[model samples]
Target: MKFTRNASANWKGTGMDGKGTINTESKILNDAQLSFKTRFADGVGTNPEELIAAAHSGCFTMQLSFILTEAGFVPENLDTKAKLAFEDGTITTIHLDLEAAVPGLEDTQFQELAQKAKAICPVSKLLNAEITLTATLLS
Candidate 1:
């Protein structure tokens, strides 16, 4: 199977003063605003790092779900939070916090699966930064 996705960005003016818009193939983001303030400071728009974090979180969680099912466990709930650190004009780290509930699953097994998911997930593989994961099994 193959999948293709596309997103476009347009910018006007200088780096700090320029304004940009981001549009994706899925249309979930249509002309989303992106500016220097948004990327550096607390601005009124979304930034690339924020979007990358969202993608990492979503992809990791979904991969974990599939891994659990394949291992004969059913995931009742899964919540993953991804944090991206951008410093010195480069992405430095990506951290993932995952909390999941799976009935009758051992901590050891869950931990192994979570780690595997973090290693094998497409987004995790694509990112060229330090990746850390904290997995908690909910009671």
Candidate 2:
């Protein structure tokens, strides 16, 4: 199967004084505001790094579930956090932290699966920056 997603942004006026809105085809984000203050200084609304992190976290979580199921393990719960680091106007790194509860799964097995997901997930492969993963198995 093949799929595509699209999001568009429109900005007007100068960088410091201008404002923009982002809209996604899914409509989950409708006319979301973004500006220089929002990107650098911490104002209201979402920014690019925030959106990237959300996508990474969501994709990694789903990939982990698929890997666990394929290995005959049922995933009870999986929580993933993606931290994106931006420096000098460039995205430097992405860190993924995963907390998982899987019944009847050993630490070694869980770690292997998490590592595979981190390496092979679609979003992970698409990123050019460094990617790190920390997996914790919860009882």
Candidate 3:
């Protein structure tokens, strides 16, 4: 299966003066070259890092959910946060934290699922940057 989203930006003037529209629909814009990617965060005007976070978080969560299901457990809720760090003008790493409510899940099983999710998530595989994960199985 394939998934996609498109973005376009128009900039004029200079930093702090030039503003660009992203997707040209959300009306979320970037100005002052603030480095706002102009896509889905900070009022839906997202940046590349935000997009990475979105992809990573969603993929990892789904992977973990599937792993849990395969392991014979049902999760009440599964939430993950992905943080992308960019420094020296390059993305360094993506850190993921997950909180899952699975009544009968053992801690070890949860860790295993998290590891598998990190290893096999499509985003993780596609990214060359390091991906770190932490998970908690909440009762």
Candidate 4:
């Protein structure tokens, strides 16, 4: 499967003083505010890092869901959180914390499938950083 998705950003003025709005093709984030304050400080809006984290977490969870179904395990719930670390103008690491509830799924198999999803997810492949995962199977 091949497809394309895009988002646009508009900015005005200097780096620290400038403000911007981001629009996505899906309209889920239409005209969302973004700025230096939002990125570096606590401001009312979203930033690149936050968006990346969202994308990574969503992608990883979905990928794991597919893998689990293929392995004959039905997932009751999969909650994933992606934490990105940015320092010195670089994204250094992304940590994925996953809590999963799946009936009849063994811990060893769950760990292997979670690791596989983390390795092969499109967003994980797109990023150039140290990726780590901690998967906990909930009984």
Candidate 2 overall lDDT versus native:
0.93
List TM-score per model, in order.
Answer: 0.98, 0.97, 0.76, 0.99
Clashing pairs in 3: 16-32, 37-47, 39-45, 39-46, 40-44, 40-46
Checking candidate 2 for backbone clashes, the offending pairs are: none
Tens-digit lDDT track for model 2 on 1-139? 8998899999999999999998999999899999998899889988888999999999999999999999999998999989999999888999999999999999998999999999899999999899999999999
The lDDT for every candidate, in the order shown, is 0.96, 0.93, 0.77, 0.97
* Winning model by TM-score: 4
Per-residue C-alpha lDDT of model 4 across residues 16-122, encoded as one tens digit per residue = 99999999999999999999999999999999999999999999999999999999999999999999999999999999999999999999999999999999999
Better model by lDDT: candidate 1 vs candidate 3:
1
Q: Candidate 1's residue-wise lDDT over 10-113, tens digit each?
A: 99999999999999998999999999999999888899999999999999999999999999999999999999999998999999999999999999999999
Give candidates' CA RMSD values in order: 0.7, 0.8, 4.6, 0.5
C-alpha lDDT of candidate 3 relative to the true structure: 0.77
What candidate 4 gets wrong by more than 4 Å, as runs, is none
lDDT of 3 by residue, 1-139 (tens): 8977555655666644445544533434323132333432253344667767987999999988888889898889999999898887788999998989998888997898889989999889999898899898887
As a TM-score, model 2 comes out at 0.97
Worst 10 residues of 4 by lDDT: 6-15
TM-score, model 4 to reference: 0.99
